[model samples]
Target: MLTTRLPTKVEPYRLASSGKCLEGVIPLADMPRVVEAIGVQESDVRISLTFDIDSQRRSFIEGSISFEASLLCQRCLRPTEPEPLSSDFRLGLVTSDALAAQLPGEYEPVVVENEQLDLLSVIEDEVLLVLPQVVYHEEADCAVSRDQLASGVEPEASDAPAVNPFSVLRTLKDKH
Candidate 1:
């Protein structure tokens, strides 16, 4: 468990140089952005990070985040837990895109704004990346019956055929 309230921010460069490792749980309630995105859920997300100076002498951070999120199923209009969301990432601290571009593809570029790396923002971004864009249960598993979904009862095709005004134009062309 992390300290009472997880750290809201950290200085990545300094931490990496010092080679500090942090493993903790961030209560769902402590993450406003995550809460705002996923709405309220039952459990806390686990956060683990290790900071070190890479071979290239750059400060880098690597970590994994895991948590369960419940999203409303579009088909049933009920909440469903799709899967336990978890992901691992590597970040290279950089202040500019030029520096970011130099980093290997394996590491994501984390821009340091005034030397501070926002911990919450990073975690929220990782979680959102793994979340489904459109949440829905499998058709077979949906609580809403298939018939209910397909019940798109389009008004019975109107009994009368529509008259095309082009018919009059064709008649006028023929008369001409």
Candidate 2:
């Protein structure tokens, strides 16, 4: 895939009869947390986009994306290489003035231009959206038991006092 940086001018911005689109890889290993959490075994991003003018009033481009990323196994905290998933989305672009009038205050807008498409931003969003909330390690020869305690000792705690914090608070309140 092409680098994450946006090109000088995205094709969609220009008032051209036809616009060209690009697709390529973006190296996200720079994000340490993302790399550590989602250990990518093998990843490739595929993007298909088109830019066109809509009735001389608005410019628009549609993007369809598919990518593969690995998730760390939850059981052993190891990397689980899963197949890539695809995401389909579209972005709308308008001038700052138009956006101020039409878009919500909290909404983010993508800008289209004369030469290239801002594919990197879209890819980042897609990856972020698809990342699983919890990554689980597959059950291979390396499954860790949930019952096992970290101290390597049985979880039976009989040598403890039967005092409760709430009870102490109640006694203090009564004394006052």
Q: Return the TM-score for each candidate structure.
A: 0.77, 0.58
Question: Which parts of model 2 have CA positions greater than 4 angstroms off?
Answer: 1-11, 15-19, 23-41, 97-108, 111-118, 138-142, 149-176
User: How would you encode candidate 2's per-residue C-alpha lDDT over 144-164 as one tens digit per residue?
Assistant: 755542657657877878778
Task: Score each candidate by Cα lDDT.
Answer: 0.82, 0.58
lDDT of candidate model 2 versus the reference: 0.58
Q: Where does candidate 2 have its weakest 10-residue lDDT segment?
A: 1-10
Q: Please give, for residues 53-89, the per-residue lDDT of candidate 1 as tens digits.
A: 9887988889998888888898888888646888899
Give candidate 1's root-mean-square deviation (CA, Å): 4.9
Model 2 C-alpha RMSD to native? 5.9
Q: Which residue pairs overlap in candidate 1's backbone?
A: none
Clashes of 1: 0
